[model samples]
Target: MCGTHGDHGRTVPPAGEGLRIVVVGKGGVGKSTLSALLARQLSRRGLGVVAVDADEQRNLAATLGVDLATVESIVPVSEDADYVEEKTGARPGGGASGMLRLNPDTSDLVDRLSVPAPDGVRLVVMGGVLRSGGGCLCPETALIAAAVAGMRLHDDDVVVMDTHAGVEHFGRALARGFDTAIVVVEPTFNAVQVGVESARMAAELGIDTLHLAINRSRSAADVERVLAYVDRLGGFQFCSTTVLPFDEVVLTCEPEVGTLMDGSPLADATVGLADGVLAGNRRPAGSVT
Candidate 1:
């Protein structure tokens, strides 16, 4: 069931279609894992899915199970001097201040730059700009923001953004036009606080369908306990606070070796969370503005 409340005007696309989603939360809260699995699930259903790795870690490709050979040479678009320069005109490397295409036409870059991923999912890597020195933030961030927000996905296409941790990096460009944001949180107070703050920042950036997922959840009681905290926040009730159990399979598997190793409860829970996130996007026929 969707843990949704309030008047979000978002509407779910018909069968064979998907909306945008940005998975974010505290570090080690499983955002990358969820992003990869969710994209894979959508693609397995024959949907067009794009997995955007906007985190500084740039490890999302590995989690999505992209060929290790491909990961070894992967460079984030934000740091790709040629591609970033071709599209934005502001080059990478040396400090790129001055004027920039804050609203560039980045329509074709998504397909051109993304690499072929498993399950028919395409991957786009975008590293963080905040840590790029405040002076270096403008040009890199402008191009990245335009690409993330301006790319128009097909009816059955889903774009999943695995964003950097915390609220410091939630800018308007990346959050715009996305249908939902699932903030993954562990069963702890500090993590929940980060989720709440992220949700708040995402809302301010115009993303309305905010939700939570309990990563590495231990039991039904633990899941419910987290739900209680989400409820106390009032405005930020999760769309469906799905639980990803702490399974041994995930713990033991080497990330570089494989993803979703055979069968994983965490993977199963992620698939359900994807469905719930989509369910929350559906508005009554007449409710959409």
Candidate 2:
């Protein structure tokens, strides 16, 4: 069942077709893992899924059961200098010194840049943000934001974006237009703090539906500790919460979500989370707005 409170009376629309989600969190909190699993789960239900890897780690393709050779060959939008210039009219190396298109037409980016994955899911990689001392990556960022905003989805399509770790992506508003954000965290102080910050930022971006995904929970006590920390932080609210158990199979597997057996703990919990995401009654909470 969804860990949702019914105190808030008004309900947001259920996540039927065209549901968009962004999975975010601190490093090593399993954001990519959750995103891949959720996409596959929805795909299994006969929904068209587009998995976006906006993370610097570049792990979504492999996690979605894409072959290693294709994963390695992917050229992220941020790193593809030629494509960047063609779309944005400014080279990434040129930085902000030259004039660039603030809003480029990225209508075909999703279809043109995406690679096919298992179960008919398409994968798009946004590449990494600029490194330290590198001049501004404004054009690159704009391209990504525009591309996300322009992705054409059919009635049965869903987008699952795996964002980079930490709060930097929020500053750029790369996740703008996403309907829901699933903040993943482990039962640790720093991780919980990051989750709180991420949740706050997601609300700021106008993403109203939020879910807290507690990964690698050893016991009920661990899950409770995380909830207590979120209460203490006190600025955001989660419409639903999911607790994924600590399973060694997650570690032994080849980092592929499909490799996890059907009845396994993580896989089962992820399917349940997908169900909650699709049908849960989402009510606006006092704190998040």
TM-score, candidate 2, is: 0.87
For 1-289, candidate 2 gives per-residue lDDT tens digits of 0133222222323334376788989999999889988888888888889999987789999999899999999998877888788888887766677778867888677778899998788899987762221234467876777777677777678899997788777754465667678889999989999998988777777766677788999998888788788877874567767888888888878668777747779988887677656664353232121
Extract clashing residue pairs from model 1: 3-239, 17-156
- Number of clashing residue pairs in every model? 2, 0
- lDDT score of residue 54 within candidate 2: 82
What ranges in model 1 sit over 4 Å off? 1-11, 14-18, 94-97, 130-137, 231-235, 256-262, 281-289
lDDT of candidate 2 at residue 15, scale 0 to 100: 38
TM-scores, all models, native as reference: 0.86, 0.87
Predicted model with the maximum TM-score: 2
At residue 48, candidate 2 shows an lDDT of 85
